[model samples]
Target: MSTDPAEAAILSTLAARGPSKSISYAEAAKALAGNPPDDSWHKSMHPIRLAAQRLARAGQIEILRKGKPIDPDNLHGVLRLRLKEQPE
Candidate 1:
């Protein structure tokens, strides 16, 4: 488990974005964008995907397919994430 700041930032941003009607890899890339060129969207994608998967497994979030969350959902398809609130 690498705790790279950039990866952590990406995960935190996604969690903060809340549950959307739909979310794409491009959207995630955009959310993690920094300065132009320096903030290359493509470079951040792989890490973002990995982070999302890890978060999903930990039950911190649910990845939805066709507007619903389920394992049968296609991994290659677009996803909408639902974030779980921290217990008080």
Candidate 2:
């Protein structure tokens, strides 16, 4: 399915903060909606997580668990997204 909006939001949010930052999927959702988390915020997650998976596969980002990257396809429990490498 088309996950462009979420994909763009994820990358933009990360790029805007540079490689020193990371973003949770919920943050991606809120960033995409241009608002804070609320009753409607959960609605944004599915698309955002899917976009996370795609971005992870493209090697443009990483899916982190316990401060380290994990396999995007096999993820479980809480996670966050960060740039695959730090800025030098």
Clashes of 2: 0
Candidate 2, pairs of clashing residues: none
Q: Which digits, one per residue and each the tens of the lDDT, describe model 2 over residues 1-77?
A: 23499999899888887765888888888888876556776788998999999989998899999998899999899
Leading candidate by lDDT: 2
Off by over 4 Å in 1: 1-7, 18-22, 35-39, 72-74, 85-88
Cα lDDT for residue 35, candidate 1: 42
The lowest-lDDT stretch of 10 consecutive residues in candidate 1 is 1-10
- How much is the lDDT of residue 57 in candidate 1? 75
Tell me the deviation in Å of residue 74 in model 1: 5.5
40 in model 1: Cα distance from truth in Å?
1.6
Residues 1-88, model 1: lDDT tens digits? 3376444654666656654434565566666665443457788787767776776777666677776775522466666555655667
At residue 56, give the lDDT of candidate 1: 72
Q: Which stretches of candidate 2 lie over 4 Å from their true place?
A: 1-3, 36-38, 86-88
